[model samples]
Target chain A: MRFTRYLAFLNKPYLLLLGYIFLSVVLMNFSDTASLQGVRWALLQVLNVVDSFKTEFTYRKNLEAENERLKKENFYLHITNQRMREMVLENARLRELLNLKTEHSYDFIAARVIAESSEKGINSRVLNVGEQGGVRENMAVVNAEGLVGKIIGVSAHQSIVQVLTDLNCRVGARLEKSREKGIVGWGGDPWLDLEYIPKNIRVEPGELVITSGLSEIYPEGLKIGVVTDFSETDYDMFMSVRVKPAVNFNALEEVFVIKTEIPENIARE
Target chain B: MNKSHLRYLLVFLAALLVQSTIVKYMEIVHWRPDLLLIILVMYAVQYGRKLGSTAGFLVGVSSDLISGGLLGLGALSKTITGFIAGGVSRLFQERSQFIFTLFLGGLIHDLIYFYINTLGKEVAWRVIWFVHIIPNLFYTAIVGMVIYYFAGRWLKADD
Candidate 1:
């Protein structure tokens, strides 16, 4: 009987695989109610350990390269330091102009890009930040280059960011030089489209675009993208404009979730 | 039964971890292979439609939660994929490699989704049909082959 049973088991190898997949789907998907904070913290700690090791390894490798380069060209080091000082001063002055004192409030929680959307319908990416990291929904996410997106969903150690180029994303943006207001939306293509700008709003091909901050999703004055081209129709109420997004959706490594001061007057109830 | 079930649970957790963390970063022209889609096709080929549909629903929900899309969308898509894969499974000889079936299954699954997404009110038919569907089909089909080979090895020993 034991030999007969063993033979039966060998005959149906796929049944075991099916059972494995079935059980996995249930375990990973449905369990939402528990705090699971301890598990998340543990996982994050492990990830942090791994990430730190990776960073340290990279840093050491770079330092060795820098040492070799510095030995070869000792004279250029002085010029590089001076250049770095000047850039730092310029960045400080810009931050002052942006009113960094009172407006910039949220203590940013740095996150890592862990996952991205593999499906056609969903145009979202996952980050390592979540409720444990003080990430709240609608938090504006930005990289050093420019605006990235906002936090739409949160898990224990992960959150999903809908990038600016997604079809569902519609940003309230204004021309930096012209101050002409228009709504920027993605057309499922790489370029973003600016809609509802009157035919004669004085927009040009080279004008810069910035978030108007009307949507309350992103902070005002963040660089969104550059206007690449425009087209006008005689019967249309608004001109169709193409924009090149500032943030490359394909190559984003790290982004900052700006904690903008939501005005008390128009705050969501 | 209990020990084997525990092993199954571990595999699912491992799949979710990879699906959410690693697979998201893999892109070729904004096209990522639905790893869960590959998993579902594998199961559908192994199990009959009834069990396959149930597995599909579960995997879909997990995908939705992790992908952060509409909740039921994964469930709906996976269920459909499961049914189709199950039907297709009948066409092949029982001894055939699971990878062949998975390769065909993934191609059809992605095509169905691409058409469904592009046919809706949200997208221009030309844009969806040409830009989205055509590229994704080719990309996913190529990925499917890789996944099929590894899957056969992974599930064969584990099973």
Candidate 2:
């Protein structure tokens, strides 16, 4: 009798849920300048704080090890740093010699990946840096490991890094070894598929892929991933190469958003 | 608000924090169980549909905002899930195993989300439904058992 009595109110849950849904939808769509909008913005800031806390929280554990490595590897670090500087100068000289008009240059803002989406299809994750950190939309994200993604959406104190693994993400990448080029798209799996790689081109597995910087989104020379698998058929015009991303999306706790220091006017070409 | 109501709010808030933070470790191949859904279902069943539905909506909205998802999608889905799970609880007696109630409900909840959000025909339905959803169902069911027992006791819900 009690169970049936409750069944009589079964629809009550539905009604209640519907009401809440309606209310949330209404509140979310409420126009700007409303006090509730301010509350919503404040709540978003709370999420950002939580994100930064997650970044610093995880980095704390490895602080000692990182320090130790930095101390001991000073010679190696110095050499690598010198090599990087030389490469930058060489790249600038090459760009100048080619008489190619440089456009859309970016200054990278080093950031930490504070949080990531547990689920895929959701292309958004919170980063520790925001406008205060000099991050902006369309800025590329990478780590020492490789290309992460780009900043699709931003909050004042927090920004969203759309991981390259997201279904909606696409990047212009080229095979470093072969110079084979294609648009890399997330294939709804952990692996990324390099689309439009001509079948005739020889792309062997283990070839490194890097951002072409053909588009304004990412800077040149940033690592993307390594070729893991390639499917080629005589009948197909394109070879589909599966790439294993360098950045471990699963364990990523820190990242750097490649921010171009170039002024907006100079960037737009 | 009554003392008990405030207590429930605290518990719900704590649950949200854990769901957002540490429980992220439970992810398997991008298939993660919705902890908020489980809590909402349990609340809806025990507290009755009205409160359950309201809680569900709140959970959905909060999750969307915190997670930076398509703003209203999670909220809408959770509200419906809360109502359905709560209404379904009337089919069982109070003494049912925690696993039976929570695991089954949670499994169904995830499947619904997978289908609604990603399993459409426009994209590759093969991966979404067959590869992802089926595995996720089993995984969430296992997680649901643990969540059910502990959460049931924590919430002190009779049904």
Candidate 3:
């Protein structure tokens, strides 16, 4: 009987809801902005402690956010490390060019190859120097490897170089051993042809070629190329000499513009 | 406290926690099933008028306070719904009848709530009755039926 009485609390009930309903109506009279700010504050303070339990419940979510932050930081670190490596390489390249500049005491402006063209008979190069950098039409362009080209067109910020590979380009070149002058030109071939060297001249396959100073553009003694081969026929007066250019234009990057001015006497000629 | 009291307390707290935390993930057309209402009505059906009404008052006031809503709206409506559901529980035996009472409790709860909420304003009561109240009751009923199916015997244990 006592157990059934203990269970009877679940069975029978009363009109206890009316008292609460009355309290609800009273609270409604003082809702939002009237008289419960202190109660709200106290309740929120209680909730703040209660919120600690909620944080533990959502701990995995916080971990996910932390993971995302760390991943982004790692990616940023990788990009910054890559930039540091590139700067180091650029510093080494600039140092080597500095040594090349110190070896020659001429007034030369360092420039970089910005672009290259590969049209069949009209191969040319572009330099990141222009009239704004005091680059003129006939100034010689060279590098540590030797001559690159000459500035053919000058804009405000860029200059077009007619390189030695162009068929229309001609360089007055001299053999280092014999000191014989010839006009060097390309005819859609990988090697430059040095014309007007007599067949009687003693030329070897491995002779050095230098600028003849016969033109106002390129300065004298600037190394141009090496004689790779030479041949002659009984009927031909000139030896068909083949010279390989010193500058490997395919791998060219940094260069210098030798400030050779056109002489007033030869400017009209 | 006894196991029953601890059970009721944990269930109430869990209902409030789920409703506040993740119920929005299950929302349909910006309307979510009132999980708290379903649990409240289930409590009333198991316990009877006196205890049911008291539970309703405590839970409703907690919801009101926790939600930063008008201080008394949930308390008032929930108190009445608990009383009526407890009263009707004596007359109903089947699960289907309890489902109908869930619908009735939700309707009474919302009607009294909106009626009190828009007491002074010139509001469209019929529109609210059709739009918010009907859909919410339907959703609550569907969820209530499923909960009662799984946990009804446990809810009425020793009663």
- Model 1 docking category: acceptable
**Alpha-carbon DockQ of candidate 3:** 0.15
Q: Write the per-residue lDDT of candidate 2 for residues A1-269, one digit (tens) a residue.
A: 98988567445555545567677667446522335434444665665677657657767988999999988799798989999999989988999999977665555677765555533366566776777878777778887798888886565667778888776688999989778778887766577888898887888889898888787677877788889898978788898888888887777766788766534753342
> Candidate 2 on B7-31: residue-level lDDT in tens?
5677667666666566667777666
Evaluated at residue A85, the lDDT of candidate 3 is: 99
Candidate 1: how close is chain B to the reference, as a TM-score? 0.75
Q: Which ten residues in a row have the lowest lDDT in candidate 3 chain A?
A: A114-123
Top model number, DockQ? 2
Candidate 3, overall lDDT? 0.72
Interface RMSD of every predicted model, in angstroms? 6.8, 3.5, 30.7
Predicted candidate 3 versus true structure: per-residue lDDT over B12-115, tens digit per residue: 88777666445545656534678778888888877777877887788887777545446677888888888888788777766466787788888888888767
Q: Which parts of model 3 have CA positions greater than 4 angstroms off?
A: A1-15, A32-36, A45-269
Chain B of candidate 3 vs. true chain B, TM: 0.92
lDDT of 1 by residue, B1-159 (tens): 344334444665566666655664577766666666666776677665665666666676566555555544566556666766776788888666355566666656555555544443355657765676667656665676676666555553443
Output the number of the TM-score-best candidate. Answer: 2
Global lDDT of each candidate: 0.68, 0.69, 0.72
Q: What is the interface RMSD of candidate 2, in Å?
A: 3.5
Candidate number with greatest lDDT? 3
